[model samples]
Target: MTSLVVPPSTLGSSFFSWFASSSSNNSLNPPKIFRKTPSNAVALYPISLKSSNRPSFDRFPRTKIWATLGEKDPNGAAPLQVVEESSSSIVDEEVEKSVKVLKDAAKTRRVAAEEVLSALSVLEKAKLDPSKFFNTLGGTSSPGRTWMLIFTAEKKLEKGRYFPLTAIQRFDAAGKRIENGVFLGPIGSLTFEGRMSWKNRILAFIFERIRIKFGPLEPLEISLGKKDEREPSSKDPFFIWFYVDEELAVARGRSGGTAFWCRCRRVNT
Candidate 1:
């Protein structure tokens, strides 16, 4: 039910008195007021004039409205510090997950090629700091020095295949030494030992000696013996490391080929 109450101040005492007198002399009915409710039904209110010629209104229930304050507000913007912290956390988690997948693929070699490629892409896009790589890959620690090539991707990174031959690489951060070897079961083996320089994510190396063995013959060593004493630079054959952990590593060579390696037992030259 709805009603409209007119104030005494709006309708003066003289008007109220005149209306009361006219109502007493003749029967009069006040207009009915209608209000539309939520159910679409019309509610009517009957108006009655009291002896004092005053009007009254019936009270209806009020709809309660509530508002929540503080950071939980959906319409509010998040603080910059919180946003940045969350974003960095997500990036770290993605890098960690990708690294795990890559390591698993390297060890088991059972993961699908497409999935491995995707994981490699994720790590490369992460662009994580190279400091850990330098220490863990070249530092003189249990898993630091030796790694065996497991898979290689072409320059376009569209397809990858496992190396048909056994190949291993070693790095010594303290001495900045690099060594590479290829074994052919008992048939023969070839080894290249060299000096390397590390700059950021790239490890540039130049071989100084070559060791070759065939059949049962003794291994022969030969030195290129370059007179230059300069250190290897970016101009030399280099590898740009994308990720390196205790178990696995992924890097791109100067020839634009990408490869993943598994940590292997260290061997002496």
Candidate 2:
């Protein structure tokens, strides 16, 4: 066996040859070296790799960073969220004020209604009679005057002295003069006895009927008696008459008769 000694250069060359062949056969395809692309895919051109042409990554603007974090400008400090909050606060205040105003108005209306009810109750309790308080007088004959009178009275400060009675007049359907005077007094007591006539017996009839219904006259009275020419004795003649003790004061006459009636009562408190 001859001694085979390896030289350093020859051994090194042999190891490098073996290493180069093994690497060529076993290594992957150099990891597919890829070129760097621009951050924005829509950019017209890729960014340059030169240090001078590339973006200054080390000197990034602080403003850009703050903008990404949703920073507002110092001069125009109001953000959308802050503005919305302020607007919402104002709207809430207005709504609250409107509600308060409506509540106050409702309270006032309720108080007014209560006062009206109280006044009406007082009027109903008084039991005032319309027939006794109002005096009827004459009116125009051509239009056939007729009136329905309403009287309202209120108690005044002095005892036995009452406020003036309020009066309203409603005319009849036939345009007849139903009421002549609307002042306070008995039929014959007024200075002017309105244009009363025997022809319009319906007027007198209505007055007597209303008095009987509302006045406290006892037994009632009929003054004007039968005017039917065919049956001079028939009691159904057309004329206003006072009824007292269920008897007629004026017997059957062709014309003028007392058409007044009254019921006496003590003044109420």
Candidate 3:
């Protein structure tokens, strides 16, 4: 992330000032940062996660509102409860987390672009939907912004069930990348329960929403692309099998030219 960081002294304004201004305006915005596209930059895709154990989430963890049983209600299943926690406090915490991470990812620290991608994969794998709640990294097209659109769609539960996902593309002043989106099918908004983070990202989100919830060591894997020679045309972009190191996992096995199980790695989950 050394490449992502910028020195405060070099800016015409204060570090926190830039953050407050930029983050306040750009949260949840699309890829709008002006970037220098690396000449060697190729097709970068997220490593799809496939695990035998399905992931689950809790939408509301703190506020508890159970239906008080009365003679008037007699049913095998009680209705879902709606607990209204102070939304502002949760929003504040999320904004703070977004600011902190944005600062780190946008810094000249050694976390670098790859680290940004890694952190993003974690969120993607867990099926977190940032759009449902706060989008602190929002922005519009900038003067010379370069962007990448990642369209991910697939069924998660039943054959007809699919997760709607969205992620923004981010490039620091130096063209390093940082961005993430989520699986959006839940009702209501998302809440930031906080996180477990290290110096340069590499965090596990502890959040809740109307549909699902996930947390640390979420049984995920990161893939290092493995090339497949077969292609409709040699000139066409060939497919790569992704594997997460130090873990045994399979996403969408190498059928139809997309393989998930051949190789995998531990995501510190």
Cα lDDT listed for each candidate = 0.56, 0.21, 0.22
Ranking by TM-score: 1, 3, 2
Which candidate achieves the best TM-score against the true structure? 1
Cα lDDT for residue 102, model 3? Answer: 24
Model 3, backbone clash pairs (residues 3+ apart or across chains), number: 33
* Candidate 2 displacement at residue 205 in angstroms: 14
Task: Evaluate candidate 3 by giving its C-alpha RMSD to the native, one decimal.
Answer: 22.3
What tens digits encode model 3's per-residue C-alpha lDDT throughout 1-269?
A: 00111112211111110111111241212232212121212222222232222222223334534453432323444455334444444533443342233234322223343443433333334422223111112122221121222211122311111011221122122222222222111211111111111111121121111112232222233322323323122122211212112111112211111111111111111
Candidates 1 and 2: which is better by lDDT? 1
Candidate 1's residue-wise lDDT over 1-269, tens digit each?
Answer: 11111111111110101111111231111112111111111111111111121111122323333345445434465433122122555566666666666666654556788877877787777776776677778876522476666677766678876543445577888788877765443355566777888888898888788788764678888986855868998887788988876666788877666778765554332
Instruction: Give candidate 3 regions above 4 Å deviation.
Output: 1-62, 65-95, 111-145, 148-269
Query: What range of 10 consecutive residues in model 3 has the weakest lDDT sum?
Result: 11-20
* Per-candidate TM-score against the hidden true structure: 0.66, 0.14, 0.20
The candidate, 1 or 2, that scores higher on TM-score is: 1
Error of model 3, residue 260, in angstroms: 22
Which regions of candidate 1 deviate over 4 angstroms? 1-85, 141-144, 267-269
lDDT of 2 at 211: 15
